[model samples]
Target: MAVGQVGGLLPHVAVPSTMPAFLIPEWGLSYGEAGLMASAYAIGYMLAAPVLTTLTDRIDARRILIFGSLLNALGTVGFGLLAEGMVSAMLLWGLTGLGFAGAYMPGLKALTDRLAPGDSSRSVTVYTGAFSFGVGLSFLACQLIADAFGWRWAFILTGLPPLIMTFVAWSLTPVTPAPRAGPLLDLAPALRNRTALGYSFAYGCHCFELYGVRTWLVAFWGFVAASGGAPLGAVVVSALFTALAMPASILGNELALKLGRHRAITLVMLLSAAVALAIGFTAGLSPWLTLMLMLVYAFTVPGDSGALTSGMAAAADPRFRGASMAVHSTVGFAFTAAGGWVIGVALDMAGGVSQPGAWALAYSVMAMGAALGPVFLWWSRRSGASS
Candidate 1:
């Protein structure tokens, strides 16, 4: 189920990379408009997470996962076959995001409910680590399919895997009894847990930085690849970097255990922010060097992902697991959308996409959000203790 959960995301992330070559040119949309359309997916995710995932407290989460997977399959297929403009694309992608809201958190709840606390945390780390591989595959798959059979075919064919995943999850995954929390929609328990809320809100800051980086990474690499006359394409390099960096999330969770979650996340954010701070200034440097630095940023940035998630899930009251996840996704995805949109706006402000300095400033904004994460956690801790 975990593998399938990750498998489903493989094609979704591909849309960003393909939009430049396929969607924007064909649909006659600017990059800013395209980013906004992409933000629609985040909008859907934010809207759907609390309502859909909360159902797990009443019914088996496997059922929710199945429903979500079906929606994902339908949405992806709809995007491929029927979408003709930004509006249609936004609707389809939003539908897909609805599917993600159901699948991801519910899948986590289903698995964690059956495990020992220590084991559950480890499982969360490993499971979230699969996201890196999924995103990497998305980039690679989109490029390969688009090169062979055009971009429409790319979307159409890539949509099939999640459908297969729907079947895999429904037939093969074990069923667990529903968690009997207060009511199906009860979030009060989760909301009242200061620790859980802190971790969740911290996750929001991390999401801002993470999504911003992932969405624009290929675009940034395009300039570097062109400047170097590199044989490898931008998507390929970005995909490889994302894949190689996948294990860092798991390793980081281990660090959380040793150093404490807040400290570990804070340290990682500072390091990543430093890289984001410097990458822009060196925009005119050698493309090879730029790629190396991007790889560094990729590794450092994702390192805190699993740690943040594990911390939140661990701190949540058992009665409000679903609700905790609900708050986590709602806040996290709100920033996810904003991250993508702000990156677009940031690009426009920096003097459009053509200028190196603009790209430099835009890149800096991506990681700057995370630099505040430690401070947020520290202040929360102090306030709670004093009160």
Candidate 2:
């Protein structure tokens, strides 16, 4: 289950870290255009989530996995080969996002349905951990390939892993049938529920920060390196930060289990916001210090993601898990898309790379978003407690 889900996420991981730096220059794209490509992918995800979740209700997850994986591979390769302009890239990325929607949550549903009793949390942790591992590995792999070969090979090479995993998934996993009777998913009720809406708002804020940071971190580090007259190892630095984040994500999951999800999420968000705010003030310090701050920020920023998802899963009705996941993903990715655009506009408005302060301002906005997540989550908990 871990392998299957991670395979699907590999492309997502690779694109954010490497593609912005590598592709923007290679493809002659403006910052706004590049941002739109990223947003286009998330738009695709938003479109597919509810539709794919509904399909999962009627079909076998294993088959869905295979189909999704194939589409992901094809779409990723297509992006490398055919993406000439912003429109073409966005179209292909949209396809990639659609494929991803099918693979991620459906794979989890399959795993949970097949649990051998008393292993739900453990199974969930393992699944989420695999996702983080895949993301880190993909970043590392893309950096290596782009450094050695070129940017296009990064996409081409990463596509092969999911293809292989798709076959493995089909052979190992069993089919699952739809449930017989339940309340049909009505968006109105989920939207009206204060707890669900609060959780969704928190997740949106989290994604706004997380995705913006991930998309721009390499560029930000590169600016710092160039200004400091340091070596051009920004990609390597970015890769290291992402690598550190993988273990942190696993640790975060365990911390959430021990400390309570709400508290754990709040702590991590506070730390992340502080680090992001401090990075600009400390940029003139030694290179190692800047890197350390970035590493710390990356490690903590995404720490609460699985916890937020777990909270949503726990709060949802069993019959409506698919719909709940759909809504969660749609809102989260929508915010991510907005973040990408905001970062791009901020960069462009500040004029070219001449101003590191612009990047600082962008990150500060992201940090503020992260800081707000805990407030909404706390409000939700208070409402629940009072009720």
Candidate 3:
């Protein structure tokens, strides 16, 4: 399932990974417009996740997974064959995000539903790690394909992988979810689960910072390369950034286990904020320094992801797991959309992407989001959230 999930994610970042060099020039888009293109996906996910993920409470998640995988394939391939400019690109990419909204958390719910209770937390964490690994592969594969066969083929080829996940869904043994007691869209139960809400809100903050950096990372590295810093191509740096997050997420979950989830997540978010701020201010130095700091930022940034996910899963009510996941994902991706767009706005307002100060302001935006995560956790606890 993990491998198949990775396959589904191959096209996940195809646009963002290649957008700076390809779409911006081809469409004559400003940084803000490009960011809007990226945010479109998140907005699509945000709009669809609550409904799609919550449906798992009554139906087999496998059904949703199969449908989602096919939609992802369609959206991705459609982008390759049909996209012409900003509007079309955003629409197709948003379709892809909607598809993913069905696949990701539903797939996780499918897996956890079959697992023994004792194994749920670790398995959830590992699956989330696989999510990062898949995203890293997306960066690498999309960039290489685009470089070799133009950006269109990048979308075309990467689109094929999601089809693999449909077969995985078909092979899964069908299991009914726990019976639900309320309306399908009623998020009140999830909202009332303060323990899960804490982790979900923290996940939102994490996604805000993570997606903001990810949406602009290739362009930022392009800046670094142009400024005579790291000469590494966007492909290598972007791929490495996400790939490093895989182990970082896994290890972070382990740290959370040992140190307590709240303390560990707090420390990691603080560290991530510090590193992001450092990157903003000092990344234009030597090539090696820039590369090193970026790698570190990558590690620090996603370090809380698995912990946050596993914590939420562990805390959620079994009967309302689908609704809980919907809340978690909706909040996370809502912030994700805002993060991607806000950073670009920051760049435009701070004197365009060429200015170092613009990049600094962008990083500061990410840093501010990360720094607020612990506060959310604190608030959740104060509100009587307990696992």
> Candidate 1's residue-wise lDDT over 282-322, tens digit each?
87577766767877887888898898888888888776788
User: What lDDT does model 2 reach?
Assistant: 0.73
Q: TM-score for all predictions?
A: 0.95, 0.90, 0.98
Cα lDDT of model 3 by residue, 57-136, tens digit: 99999999999999999999999999999999999999999999989999999999899999987898888998989999
Write down the lDDT that model 3 would get.
0.91
TM-score of 2: 0.90
TM-score of 3: 0.98
Candidate number with greatest lDDT: 3
- Please tell me which predicted candidate would have the highest TM-score against the true structure: 3
Instruction: Say what the RMSD of model 1 is.
Output: 2.1
Q: Which segments of candidate 2 are over 4 A away from where they belong?
A: 13-22, 172-175, 178-185, 188-197, 229-232, 385-387
Q: What TM-score does structure 1 among the candidates reach?
A: 0.95
| Each prediction's number of clashing residue pairs | 0, 0, 0
Error of 1 at 290 (Å): 0.8
Q: List model 2 lDDT by residue over 1-387, tens digit each.
A: 777666666677555656556778777877767777877777887787776765555566667667778888888888777777677878998998888867777677667667754676666666766776676677677778878887777877787677765876677656557564553445554564566656677888888987787777667777778667554476676666666655676788789889987788899988888898888666645667777787788688778777776667666566566667667777888888888878878778776444767766777788888999989888887887211
Give me the runs in candidate 1 sitting further than 4 Å from their true place.
Answer: 171-183, 385-387
- lDDT: which is higher, 1 or 3? 3
lDDT for residue 13 in candidate 2, whole number 0-100:
55
